[model samples]
Target: MTSASPTRAPGPFSRFEWLVAGRYLRARRRDAFISVISALTMIGIALGVATLIVVMSVMNGFRDELLGKILGLNGHFTGFPIEEVFHDYEAVRDRLEGVDGVIAATAFVEGQALVTSQYASSGVNIRGMSIGDIEKLPLLYSSVLYGGWDDWDNLEGVAIGSRLAGQLGLGIGDPITIVTPNGPQTPFGSTPQIRSYPVNAIFDVGMVEFDSLFVYMPIRAAQVYFRLYEDRLRDGVAQPDLMASDEEIDAAYERVYTATAVEVFVADPDATARMQLPLEQATGRPMVFTDWKQRNQTFFSALQVERVVMFTILSMIVLVAAFNIISSLVMLVKDKSSDIAVLRTMGATRSSIMRIFCITGTAIGFIGTIAGFVLGVVLALNAEAIRAWVSNTLGIALFPPEVFLLSSLPSRVDPVEVSVVLVMALALSFLATLYPAWRAAQYDPVEALRYE
Candidate 1:
């Protein structure tokens, strides 16, 4: 007697199902149109993901560079006396420096003045600070391209920015004229104080606005020029004489120095809010304080909003590519309906047929996402060089430092953000396949083959 043939079973997603999926994905000349559509879908997804990564990276770069430069030059926060004058600035400065988490505190005096050289004239902001304070700020101290620090404290001496020097055609040891209306008042009215100061140093801070508009002078000089001072002697007003003997100094102290405000530097700028109260208590005075974020809120808020809008708008590219995936799968399901029906009649499970189509679509998504991730990372790593190359080869100004406020284009890729983009792309692609795969699995074998 002949033994009964053992029944065969094609388990869900078995090699048989994978084989069928691979065959369908292979581009046949007869289904060339569907093959082209699938290819375009993959290309679309790749381009979309790459663009998202690049744009996000650029935005992050811009934010970080700007914040560093801003906080580097301006410190994290500042305070101006609410009473209009910080009496005994030396004591106040010392107290602020002694506080925990405080990097340094400077008695900062600032005033607006008109500067003129043989070449040109411009309105500039003069910062009056001691040489000791300048040493604590790396942005200014490390950026001195010419001249020495000793000359900064010399009588009628100053430090100017590189761009300012260029504009005024001034160099080290060259004198620049400053005119401030807030100077000592005369019999008629307020008279502009005009003084010529020799340039001791020139600095380029890699920022346009600051480099062009800032002038540094001795704090004593600033206080004198801005008319911010207090007389100690009850008789005629007299400026302090540091060389006076102890008996002469005791007889009548000429004057005491003062400041417009105190600038505080902290170890952690992000902790500005938490440090504010402590800093105030340390100052031992009533004061009004301002932080960097508070000062540049509008500018930073706009940046954040723009980043979100850009992401939302660019994500539509991936969404459209996902729609392309759905379209290609739908056409594929129609073309393979006969094969699906034949398999069903031969005892193939419905789940196996569905998995076949799902695999085909998801493979495209996975490969496309990987291609995009690699391409995006490479582009971000070389964004600045690429920008320079493109600008040079095209013979055009791509990013002018004066307008863009930076010497070069910046890009920084975050690994977490990139992973998110990849996962999102793959998820969209997988979702695009479900309806078409389900339709293919639901085909009735009897009806599908009756007409064939």
Candidate 2:
């Protein structure tokens, strides 16, 4: 009886197919050159991935750190009055506060001024915000090193940045004199508005711009300092004496509770680019809205461009490694022609032969990619320690604070970015295998066996 034609197989693919694929990956002593090339290919890919990981992580850290500081001091979107001051600022602030994305909305006044202490004098940006607003900002509140936000609320003093205080040789409780550009208009021309407030706190925002030039005062004090009181006086508000009591200062500040701009903090600053029109429409006033991205576009744009350029340049190293994989596989196919002929004689199909080499080449790339991912993550996590070690050992500073603005090297790996890198590596490697694997598959079994 003719037994039922031998069952072809139970599974989709034969076990023998994988067994032969695995065997092709091992090199005999005679094929030692191929083995060496394969090893070099793996090493090159690993190094490229590791370097890319370190660089991208550092850039991500830099962007995040700078963004945190910038957003800390500034707003996601700021609405400026078309006129000199926002007369209906409370209405505007209330409207903005009711917006969906706005977490907090506050009135702010910022202007250039000269601050003087007993020891020295420096130009600074006099910024005014309410005590309640200051307390709402953890970045500002937690950065206070010497005193509390309560001091600013009590109208007892103002908070100056750390570098400003250092330059003026002043500290908390020391008196700081401010001279505003818009001074009282007197018959003897306009004299600079001068006011002295005790330094109630010192803040270190870790940014040269902020630390060296910004001084924070209560909204009323800032109004008085910036001559906003002049507008109040015009509106039938009584002018107070220089040694005005706290009650008088409160009344004066309340009368002129207008802001030059309303700073709106959002849940996501990155999305602020698209919110300008919406914000302007919501404010229901003829106001101009400026987002933080627009304010620092050049800086952030440069970083993004550099990151793209760096990624492209670094990916070339992996491409070169892929070339090595091509060469090794090509040589391997040439050397194993006799084996191909024998396997074909043993009933192996042409597609099976191609899959064997493809598997071999992909295994090399897959293994190398895994090794690279591990090495990259380790290096990125310990980048600071590595920087310190290299600096100490080499007697050199890799990134100087004076030049880089940051005190130390920083790195932060994003998992999504890492996954993209890994995928790129594997794709390049698998693509590199196509030509060589196809070449192996094209061998004429008749001619190959004729020579054998």
Candidate 3:
């Protein structure tokens, strides 16, 4: 028995591991039909990945751009009362200032009026603000395309939006008549008066609607012009016949003067409700607070829905490519059945047989996914260049400046999004290999050898 000991053989890997895997890939190349199918599958995955990346990045860029436009034009939150006027505005401002998240507090008068120039007339929204308070708002400071807030401080002058100026055919230092409801005691009786203001400067915020409708002036000037404190007497009541006295006029005026409103700016745009609570308590008015999100909810919601729909549609391509992988693997199992049986007879484990096919399928997915990711990043980073190339080559604009807010294509490739996409592609590829690999591993050595 001691003399009959036999030498142990080396493992199968040392004998034929590299050769087996290399031969499988090479054999695939030699089969023209299989090679074509594999090539198509690779192309499909690449196209799918590339499209998904470009589309998602573009959507992200668009979302950022749209949000910037909205936030820049409008502040995060605006706190105002349900009533036409709020009394004790100073108290309201004090309460808001004491709040944790409030950035700034300012008082403003808002009303509708008709603006008339010698050559034209246009209806506009009159916004009255203190020049000092206006400067505190960062959006206004940054958006000052022309002129400064100082222009509003001057009593005789008003600042008009650039587009409004264009529409009215007016410029700086031009005289414009503003007709507001101002109650003045004339020789006959108290009647509504109209005042004229000189346009001192023009500002353009790059937003067409704001430019066309907004006109800013000093708060005091607006209060004086509109005569907010003037009271409307009861119908059929005569001043002398009813024996109305100065005390009554003074009391009525006091009623109007006591009403005031404060607008607070919050640090976090999303804290509108929190900021409103303090203002509502101080003013004793029903406070209505609005944020940018609520203001443009429809637009932002549409963008999100579009993104999801686009991603789902593009994912179908990857699904189709995965199916192609399944087809390739099934064909591969048939081609390798004889070799699988020979290896089994040599005591190769079923798990190793399955692993070989799994590795092959995973290699294909990995290669295609990586290639697509690289290509997508390159295209996304150079989207403007690609857009220009397409435009120049086709002699047509890919993204028309008039149609889109941005003149060129925009893209922002987020690393996290790219990582998720790559992981999904790899997972799909791995899943595609499982069934075929399992089938290959279940091959019977005797039956496979008999057929060979």
Candidate 4:
């Protein structure tokens, strides 16, 4: 049996240490300034943590909203003809759909056109899609503010964006003329096709760009208006007159068709690159394939860089609070020097003295961090509502749809990020206590009491 060392220290964080730590933290007339400093330190920490959480959550929300709107409307991947226009799109669509992980394939004819209403005119990109494929994009069909998908195909009319309709002073059933340079080639030059189609539906996607610059029409009408597919008599055959009989109109339906592009959707958009090879094999043609990430690389890259920068800048708040902790602990140690000496003379170990100050300082940080965490979560969860309330009271558009892509503010609180912040704050607080606690533990009882 080994003999116990006579100078063995008491168990760590003993009851005595906690009692002394509590006593020192309590407000006293002599230590009023120290208490004030400690209070300010805790407040600084709370404010810093709360601000970081709110900013990070808002940035995350912005990124997610933008990504979802862009990708939701434009699919995960798209391919266009490199050599020739996408011919036999039906068969190509089927083949592309057969690829592993491919969710759906939609063939679309997109062309730049100038849309004119009686009031105004705007340059718009017109996308033509079949009803079956149109329904696949829930972001479009589901957002129809007025009018709907009913009789959408039979009407041969068009769907215009809400903003476009508003700007042109047009409503549902109003005729909107479209002029495009993609018409038939004539002796003079490429003849511009000018035709008017009634607006049958209106959609508001809550995104300024999309809501203001897009028009949707049935696939057949788009093919006809854009001259993508046409039926005519053989060369040298007599062309039918404008008032051709119904029989002639029926016969004209027989013609070859082509599509400008095909958009593919996959199960997981983030892994879109993995589906490239399979899509190429399925197409078996020289096609230009582009994914969402590649198309928006610069935009999303900027967002990521901004997030990191914000985190670094806001972390300084917590750092400043940690510095305050050091200042406050040092002051507390000075004010309690005599008490520390008395405790030392009464059989209290140096470690106990150190722990007293450590506990006092750590307590402030722990409580502050918890308070900040709670405040952050509450604010993040209700960020949009708060924005609305403030904006209403101030009579300002906080997040205007035209300026910001999203109509309303958005926030998403990530648990992992919150956890990291708490740990970092606690670590800084603990570190700040070390030197002050060490100084308190080094008190000399004989020298300290000699002056008394």
TM-scores of the models, in the order given: 0.90, 0.83, 0.73, 0.91
Going through the candidates in the order shown, the clash numbers are: 0, 0, 2, 0
336 Cα displacement, candidate 2 (Å)? 2.3
The parts of candidate 2 lying over 4 Å away from their true place are 1-14, 116-122, 166-169, 175-181, 186-188, 193-196, 231-257, 268-285, 392-395, 401-410, 445-452
Q: All candidates' lDDT scores?
A: 0.86, 0.83, 0.73, 0.88
> Which lDDT value does model 1 have at 141?
85
lDDT tens digits, residues 177-277, model 3? Answer: 88755467789877756788878668765555667788878877876676655465645544443576887664444334322345566677766666656
lDDT of 1 by residue, 61-118 (tens): 9888888778887868788888656657778888989989999888878889999998
Worst 10 residues of 1 by lDDT: 3-12
Model 3: pairs clashing at backbone N, Cα or C within 3 Å: 86-260, 87-260
lDDT by residue for model 2 (105-140), tens: 888878988889889999988888888788767888
lDDT of 4 by residue, 277-389 (tens): 88988986778899998899999999999999999999999999999999999988888778889989888888878888999999999988888888988999999999999
Which residue pairs clash in candidate 1? none
Q: Which regions of candidate 1 fall more than 4 Å away from where they truly are?
A: 1-13, 234-253
For model 1, the local distance difference test gives 0.86
Q: Name the Cα RMSD for model 2.
A: 4.7
Best by TM-score, which number? 4
Task: Write out the backbone clash pairs for model 2.
Answer: none
Candidate 2 has an lDDT of: 0.83
- Winner on lDDT between 2 and 3 is 2
